[model samples]
Target: MADQGVRTDRLGLLLEQFDQAREMAQVRLTGLGDEEYLWEPVADCWSLRRRGEAVTPRAYGPGEWVLDKGAPDIPASEYAEVARQAAGGMPVSKIAEDWSVSVERVGEVLAFTGTPEPDRTPVTTIAWRLAHLHSCFAGQWEWTFGERRRDPRLLVDFTPRAGLALEAFWATIDRWREDVASVTDEQLDTVGFSQYPYGSDPDDPFIAVVAGSGLEFIHHMAEIALLRDLWRARFPGRG
Candidate 1:
């Protein structure tokens, strides 16, 4: 009985943390416009992009939008074409001309196997940040309470438009919260309770995962708020 009380208390604390964070983020997100959401403060910032406009080696997400993150092992625009041509017995030189790159560059693209390093992470706009938060919540919820087999990359629907993005993000949060609210004290103490594959949730107690998720929400929401402030400062009187 004592153990049950302690677990219930821990779960309540975790949920409270998330509630506070979500409330603060909601306040920050009010009146955010499309221009402000997609505003890039600096060059080469990571962001959500329309298909074929992404500079990264590969983009993930459904529809016409995707996140700009590198996956060097996955062949991208010219790189994918090069690989296809080479597989079809086309010469490297011919493929190079078709791809508008030197043969050597095509070769390098084919041989590339390194993802972007953490030290080189770029600044992200509000759209990207919000999409990331949405993905994290949606993915965790899916793995924890839904099918538990879907790829996280396919779990979110990214959008270049801010209004739709915000709507979807909040909807995901609601779904996640609904499921999390039902977790029992026994489940809270159960290791592998979350089973979210992208993180260490499987090895940690459910309560810890809940706490860590709250941390992720708080910090990312803080970052999003800061980005909004910076955007407002950069373009006074602008959305």
Candidate 2:
């Protein structure tokens, strides 16, 4: 703690909160099979699918932005407006499409952060939600401590299968814990310590980034759990 300025206890508390949220998500995802992982309660309901067709343009309803709304062939104006109105970033499907996951299943959390949301955020599968959590976990760690500076645009294609996705989430968290312990508490007080690209880290303190990430985990983990509850209720026998 040579660089101690703020308080390490604060970081420990943040990690505790982060771990608790992750535990909730893990419990929610327990026993979720392929059917539950990719189940679509509604037509064109967005969920992770068998790579290509499971989450492609062909499956979406008319007027629905293609799953890969950000795809080069699809005009930005098309999905951009949807985001503006939806109060989140581009549609989850669009990000899946860009991942080129034509061979396996995909899952993710909606990018309901800073980006505008879509007019209707499709019901996402557990697989997609897990992927989103883990992906963000990985991205945040890389940017905050690893110096990788991962690009958010590339995340659309970074889908993983179910169990692996969960494992990845913890793996990243573990890595962050090991890496962050040595981060002088004083570093937390310094402005712009995060240096992440997807967020306003350049103008904020490292402590804010740490707290925000913990909140992000808590926020999405609860949402994921709720989706699982709704999914079970929607399909009784499966639940």
Candidate 3:
């Protein structure tokens, strides 16, 4: 059983931080113009190229062979299976790499309004990244919210890309913010609220997971902001 006062305090703090993080992302992205979205501060940094076309230099990590720039909104399990079957033994590190790449691509797409090419070799594009992010978020949320517990290894399939990539990205963050904000003290201390199987305590309270996600949101928001600034500097006047 959880202590009521403590749980309330923690829940309040988590919700506050979640709101702040979303607000920050909104502020950073709101004024961004098209040209500034793809500015690379330095060489070797990847940008979103024409859709279907792969960004140069950076290779698609292990199991990301086929890239679908279209929005399928497929279930997370199916998406994970595809990656597993296609990208044999895709390591966990590759997931992190893809995350970084996706962040960069989204920055590019937001900064510039270019007609991405279709009907080409599917490369990891911004749309793909957004789909992946959404799946991961939904997976995590399912653990924390629905089952209120976690699997040993949370299996999430990252989609190649979806049509509503940008819209979904924004919606995802928004949903996270709302969900976090809605968590009450009762929810926080409820064991099995977080189904993070990797955690030492799978039955840990939801508050802990919310706390971690809040931290992650802040980190990613900063990354997005930095990318936006880089794009702004590179593009100057073009929107």
Best-performing candidate as measured by TM-score: 1
My TM-score estimates for the predictions, one after another, are 0.75, 0.62, 0.50
Q: Tens digit of lDDT per residue, candidate 2, span 1-239?
A: 53864344887777767666767666776876656655665666555444355545443212211122222232322444334423445344444354343212223222323543444455565555555655566666777776665564343333334555456666777787677666888998888777666544654688887887777777767766787788778778873
lDDT of each: 0.80, 0.57, 0.50
For residues 1-239, could you state the per-residue lDDT of candidate 1 as single tens digits? 56555344667777777887889899899989988998899999889988899878767787788888764332353355456657778777765655445778778877866552334467988988898888889889988999999988788879777888888999999888778889988998898988887655776788888888888888889999999889888888986
Between candidates 2 and 3, the one scoring higher on lDDT is 2
Q: In what order do the candidates fall by TM-score, top score first? A: 1, 2, 3
User: What range of 10 consecutive residues in model 1 has the weakest lDDT sum?
Assistant: 71-80
Kindly list the per-residue Cα lDDT of model 3 for residues 1-239, writing each as its tens digit.
Answer: 25554344667767766777777766766755433443445544443444345544432322333223332222332334334422555443433243333434333433434443443333232333333445556657666555644431233332333233445666766766677677777877777666644331244567766777667667655766666665556666655
Model 1 clash pairs are none
RMSD of each: 10.9, 10.8, 14.1
Report residue 194 deviation for candidate 2 (angstroms): 1.6
Q: Indicate the worst ten consecutive residues by lDDT in candidate 2.
A: 60-69
Q: Top lDDT: which candidate number?
A: 1
- Give residue 208's lDDT in candidate 1 (0 to 100): 81
Segments in model 3 whose C-alpha atoms lie over 4 Å from true places: 1-8, 31-135, 146-163, 196-203
